[model samples]
Structures are given as C-alpha cells and as structure tokens.
Target: MSILATTRTVARHRRLSRLELAAYIAQLEGQNTALIAGNTALAAQLDQAANDISGLSEDLRVARGENLRLDAALTATNARLANATSVGSLPQHVSTQPVPIVQRFESGPVLRAGASPLAAVTAPGKRGDVDKTQPLPVVTTT
Candidate 1:
C-alpha cells in the first residue's frame, strides 16, 4: 500500500480503539455507581437490623427481670405453703378457757380547743348512759 493510505488506516484504527476504550470506561463507571448504591442500601438495612436486635435485647432483659421476680414470689408462696402444711400435721388441742365475745363502740377523737390533734384515744363505753343489756366494751391499749 502507499504510505499515505497506510498512515490513514493506522489513524482510523487508533480512533476506533480510543472510542472502544471510552465506551468500556463509561460502562465500568455505570457499574461502579450501581454497586455503590447497592452497598449504601445494604448498609442501611444492616443498621436497622442492629437496632432491632438492640430493642429485642432490652425486651429480653426485662423479661428476665420479671421472671426473676416471679421466681422469688413463687419461692415465698411455697415456703408459706410448707409452713401451713407442717402446722396442719401437728396435734390439735382445744383450750380449757372459754373465749369471750366482747363488743365495742368507736368514737372520733374529741378536740378540746387547746389540745393537740395527736391526743390519746379514750376507753370505749365510758359515757354514763350505757345500758346494762349491752356487753361492756373492751379497751385496747397499744
């Protein structure tokens, strides 16, 4: 071939190669952009999953605390039941003394003008007009 024709052919081949390289670079850029977006979405999902796990861990901790409280209550109830059963197994004996049934009437504390509000409670049925038909009131001292 003539020198000018050969130079033209080489120039055309180089231009074609440059266009192919540019197209390949553009395709790689597009793929990189898609990969970056996918990575960002996956990272968000991972963060959400981590938050969910943290919440579940807190719930599990609360449940464990509640279970421990229930277990303590169960232990106390079982102890009481054991004590009651043991008491039931003991011999029963009636008391020799007759139990008296006492009756009582309660009155609000009387306020004398100068007296402190924390005054002591008085004996019941101390009022003079009490009828003999009613049983005498019992006085309780603390």
Candidate 2:
C-alpha cells in the first residue's frame, strides 16, 4: 500500500489501543475503590470485636474475684460455726435423781393424787411404761 495510508492505519490502531487501555484502567480503579471500602468496614468490625472481648475479659475477672471472696467468707463462717459448736457443748454432770413433781399454788406447794411430795418424778418409757428415769440437767443462763 501507500506509505501515508500505512502510517494513518498505524495511528488509528494506536489510538484505539489507548482508549481500550484507559477504559481498563478506569475499571481497575473502580475495583480498587470498592476493595478499600470493604477493607475499612472489616477493620471497623475487628475493632468492635476487640472492644467486646476486652469488656468480657474484665467482667470475668471481677466475677472470679467475687467468687474467691465468697468462698473465703463461707470458709470463715463454717469455721466459726464449728468453733461455737465445740465450745457450747452441754454440761457433763447431770443429776441422776428424779425431782419431785410439786404444783405450787398461791398459798403453798400441793401434791396431786397418786403422787407424793417426797416421791421422785419419773418419765414414761418408750414402751408406755412409767419406770424409766431420765436424768435432768440444770441450765442457768447468765
């Protein structure tokens, strides 16, 4: 072909190639913008998750400390109860002799029928017999 016609054809081809390259570059830029937005959103979510984890960790620490305090208080209470029980035991010496059942009136003490004033009071046995004698312990509160 002629030289001018060949040069014009090469120029037209180069212009078309540059237009296609510019359109591709625009598409790549749009895709890059979308990727940057998505990365920012992901970073925000990661920051929120980290804050939540930190709050939960603090709550767990407080709960563990409260649990330890409650455990110690319970242990101390149990020890106090054990000591009180050991120290507040009943007296060992109790009167084995039964006391007389005397009903005192405004005037003086009276004895019922079938009961003597000098006779010792006896409690009934488990088998319905009145022969069992239970020891009575005198209690005095100061």
Candidate 3:
C-alpha cells in the first residue's frame, strides 16, 4: 500500500511536466512560423532585385555595341575626307587636272581677259574694248 501511493505521486508529477513541455514547444512553433514568413518575403525581394540587375546588364551591352558602330563609322569618314582633300599628295595613277587655278586680289584696277592693269586701256564708265598699244605714265613709290 505504501509503494502504490509513491507510484501514483510520481506519475502525477510526470504528467504535469509533460504538459509544461508541450506549452513551451507550442510557443517555439509559433516563432518558427513567423520566421518562415519573414524569410519568404526576403526571398521575393531578392528575386526582384536580380531581375532588375539582368535588365540593366542587357541595356549596357546594347549601348556598347551601338557606340562601337558609331566609332567605326567616324573612323571611316575621317579616312575618306583625308583622301579627298589632299592638296598636292594625290596618287600618281589617279589622273587629275594639271592646270593651276590662280585667284587674284583686287588692289588698284579691275581688268579681265588678258588686259594688263598697268596699261590704261579704257577709262571708268566708258564701254570700250581693251587697247594693248599704249604707253602709260610710270608712277614710282620708293
């Protein structure tokens, strides 16, 4: 009878301890559920950031390719202009005009078609042809 009373007391104490442990486990399970929810939200944000990064990388690649094309076109145009605008260094095989074009400046008189400005052929406001047989006065400015 004494042993049976001691066994019942211990069994009741064990049952109470099991109930306390179960409550503690339930609290930990609730915390785990909240932490899992937070982890899911963080994963979604990371995925969105990765997607934006990929889009920017593709745009940079396209811009670089366009810049390279424009650089190549500029180099070609410079070469073509350098070839066309040569003053005296043209190729020997490529035939060009040999006659030199002389540009005269206006200083004293306006003469045209082989008429010399040193010899006065016609006066101003007179409609007359150039006279080659004339000896004009020589004015010297030392």
Reference-based lDDT, each prediction: 0.71, 0.72, 0.74
Using TM-score as the yardstick, the better of models 2 and 3 is: 2
Q: Which candidate is the best by lDDT?
A: 3
What is candidate 3's lDDT per residue for 1-142, written digit by digit as tens? 6999999988887774767889999999999999999999999999999999999999999999999999999999998898799777778876564433232232244446456545556554577755654343343322
Model 3: pairs clashing at backbone N, Cα or C within 3 Å:
none
The 10 consecutive residues of candidate 1 with the worst lDDT sum are: 101-110
Clashing pairs in 2: none
lDDT comparison, 2 vs 3, better candidate: 3
Considering only N, C-alpha and C atoms within 3 Å, which residue pairs clash in candidate 1?
none
What is the lDDT for 135 in model 2? 35
TM agreement with the true structure for every prediction: 0.46, 0.42, 0.40
Ordering by lDDT: 3, 2, 1
Q: How accurate is candidate 3 locally (lDDT)?
A: 0.74
The candidate 2 region of ten consecutive residues with least summed lDDT is 133-142
TM-score of 3: 0.40
Among the numbered candidates, top TM-score falls to 1
Candidate 3 contains a number of clashing pairs equal to 0
**How high is the lDDT of residue 139 in model 3?**
36
- Candidate 3, after superposition: displacement of residue 43 in Å? 1.0
Better by lDDT, candidate 2 or 1: 2
